[model samples]
Target: MISRLSRELSPHLTYHSLYHTRDDVLPAAARLGRASGLNEDEYLALTTAALFHDTGFIDTYEDHEAGSIAIARAALPDFDYSPAQIDRIADLIAATRMPQRPADPLQELLCDADLDLLGRDDFMRLNRALLKEVRHYSHRPVPDDTWMRDQLRFIEEHRFFSPAARTLRAAGESHNRALMRAALASTNGANHAAGGLA
Candidate 1:
């Protein structure tokens, strides 16, 4: 099933913007399986979950989770996943919502993997690029301050969900905190500088 899903998406996936970083996905999946108590079926579910999680980009950016759910449901109809499994996937996707806490281990793994780069050394550059992607794809102008505020709220309100995510990736929270604080300070300094210029 995982192979089939990957094969189906392969040709269509190449033209997307973040197509290059597709390999980073599997490691996250492997980590999820190792860290959580997922069995073979659950692991397959997670793999499918990881592959299609961001597929909403193919349609429209807004509510891509719903789009992903649609894609997953359509592709896996033969799998005959129970209502609980379907709901779990849907809820896991929804847990990717900004400023929301993940409710379980699976959701936590998804959330952490989705934002896995938060602790990376290149986070600032990556974040700026994401900002650019949003501005370009969504056709919405996002100022630095607004972006910082959104991140600040997220950092303040959220935490890693699973013990594995927390233990393995806890440093990311501090890194994000430091970056957020620096951004806030820089914004304030810019405002003061502009006041003097005015």
Candidate 2:
């Protein structure tokens, strides 16, 4: 899976690359899973979901969760995953869809793990990468002011579903929010200055 992602994921995916799944989301799922007291089966399902969550990006960018689920459904049976287990894994992967409405505990854990970076110190670095990726796919530049405002709004609106994520990431999320606000103000000021000169 890792090799497939490394080879097949589009170069345009700076943020959603294989590195994101392997380096960020997978580890985060394990960390949060341990903290949340997941049983062995639950942990295995959650980790599997995390591993395949963004793999849809290998074939398609939009609505990739569906792609992920299809891949998981096809692949898990080969690994001896039971039908019910594959269904659970599929549900967990689907829970990560945007406007993330996780209806169960494992789903919550997977959702939180998918977005763990929002509360981490590296939020801006990854945020920038996402912006770049978006620009590449959208084929247009996102103005600094607009992008900053959108990011601030997203952070302000986002909530971690798992207790472990809330405990570990809430403060970091707040800090990142403040940083985003400051950056937005700075960007607005710069744009205003440029307009005044014009």
Candidate 3:
């Protein structure tokens, strides 16, 4: 079932988002397994939700959470997942939507995994790569300073829900902020030089 979903979903999604998230998702879910409240079925639901959480990015970048929900609904029929499990998975995937304020621990785990990179070690580099992905697909060239500012705004606005992610990934968040300020300064310096030379 996992293989079938991976095969169908991989083709449409860009590699960058998948590459980083795939490495972290299962491990994060495994860690979440250690938590007390989640039972076995709930664990499976969380794992399934984590796996397909980003699948919506395959068909479209904007509102891929809905896209992921649609993908899971379509693909799960063959797997014969119980209706309750299906609903759980769908809810978990949808929990990753922006403006997400998860009400329960399970939803929080999936949300943290989905936005896990916000706390990643290579955040600055990854941020550049994400900007590049957008540029490639949307044909919108984001200047370094502009990209940095956007990333800074996003970092300020968002945070990881899990304690592990927050504790481990905080450096990346701070580093990205510093990188953004530098980029803004550099862009302004270049503009000032151009005007002075003219």
Candidate 4:
């Protein structure tokens, strides 16, 4: 699956690439699953969900969660995953959709793992990767101020659902929020200065 993703995902998907799912979210899910006391089966389900979550991006970017679910449904059966297990995996993947309404502990863990980078020190780096992806899909350059504002708003509104995620990432998220605010202020000031000179 990782190899397929690396081969097939669009070159423009800088942030949503195979690396993001396989390298970043996968590890985070494992860590959070252990921290959250998932049993062996639940841990398997969560890890499976994490790997398949962003895979929809390979086919389409809009409503990619649906694509991810479809891929899982098609693929998991061959791996001897039970229908019930597939359903749970589907639910976890769906929970990662925007506005991130996780219905249970496992869902919460998957959702948190999906956005774990948001609360890490590498937030800015991954944030820029996403910015680039957005610009690519939108077919235009997003203004720096606009990007910063959107990021700040998202960070402010976002919350980690699982206790483990909150304990691990909340402080880092706060730090990133402050960085976004400062960056936004500086960008606005620079823009204002440029306008004044004009």
Model 1 C-alpha RMSD to native? 4.3
**How would the candidate models be sorted by lDDT, starting from the highest?**
4, 2, 3, 1
Q: 1-198, model 2: which lDDT tens digit per residue?
A: 899999999988999998899999999999999999999999999999999999899889899999999999999899999999999999999999998999999999999999999999999999999999998988888887889999999999998988999999999999999999999999999999999999
Candidate 1 weakest ten by summed lDDT: 12-21
TM-score, candidate number 3: 0.80
Model 2 lDDT-worst window of ten: 137-146
Question: lDDT for every model?
Answer: 0.68, 0.94, 0.72, 0.94
The residue-level lDDT of candidate 4 at 130 comes to 94
Best by lDDT: 4
Better of 1 and 4 by TM-score: 4
lDDT of 4 by residue, 1-198 (tens): 898898999999999998899889999999999998889999999999999999899899999999999999999999999999999999999999998889899999999999999899999999999999999899887998999998899999999999999999999999999999999999999999999999
**Model 1 stretches astray by more than 4 angstroms:** 1-21, 24-26, 77-88, 99-101, 137-140
Clashing pairs in 1: none
- Listed in order, each prediction's TM-score against the native is 0.77, 0.98, 0.80, 0.98
* Local accuracy of candidate 3 as per-residue lDDT tens digits, 43-162: 888888887887776677788889889888988878889878898899888887877888788888887766666666666666667776777777767776677677678878777776
CA shift of 185, model 2, Å: 0.5
Q: Could you give candidate 1's per-residue lDDT for residues 9-80 as a string of tens digits?
A: 434243333432265554676686787878876776666677767666557667777887887777666678
